[model samples]
Target: MMTTIVDLMVFIIGASIGSFLNVLIDRLPKEENINGRSHCDHCGK
Candidate 1:
């Protein structure tokens, strides 16, 4: 039971990190300023 709980915690942490990275990947190409708010490359809003 303890092993299963540990595994679940690890899985949740990994998934959360993966999702955050995905957002960066999606916005990187379009956004010029990575440090600031994520927006479109063309609009530059």
Candidate 2:
């Protein structure tokens, strides 16, 4: 039980990180400073 819970937490954390990276990748080309704070792909920050 504990191992499964820990594994699930790890998966959740990894998924969250992947999601953030996906947002950055989707936005970096047009509307963001890649080294700076994140914002939507269609808007500048």
Candidate 3:
């Protein structure tokens, strides 16, 4: 039971990190700022 709980916690943390990396991967190629409100890709609104 303890192992199951630990596994779940690890998975959640890892998934959060993976999600963050995914966002960086998506934005970095376009030279977008890593922090700030979202903007329109074409209009820059």
**Taking the tens digit of each residue's C-alpha lDDT, what string does model 2 give over 1-45?**
999999999999999999889878876666755576655545744
Clashing pairs in 2: none
Error (Å) of candidate 1 at residue 9 is 0.3
Best candidate, lDDT: 3
Ranking of all candidate structures by their lDDT, best first: 3, 1, 2
- The C-alpha lDDT values of all candidates are 0.79, 0.78, 0.90
Q: For candidate 2, which ten residues in a row score worst on lDDT?
A: 36-45
Off by over 4 Å in 3: 38-45
> What are the TM-scores, per candidate, against the unseen true structure?
0.66, 0.65, 0.74
Query: Which residue runs does candidate 1 get wrong by more than 4 Å?
Result: 32-45
Q: How many clashing residue pairs appear in each of the predictions shown?
A: 0, 0, 0
**In terms of TM-score, how similar is model 3 to the real structure?**
0.74
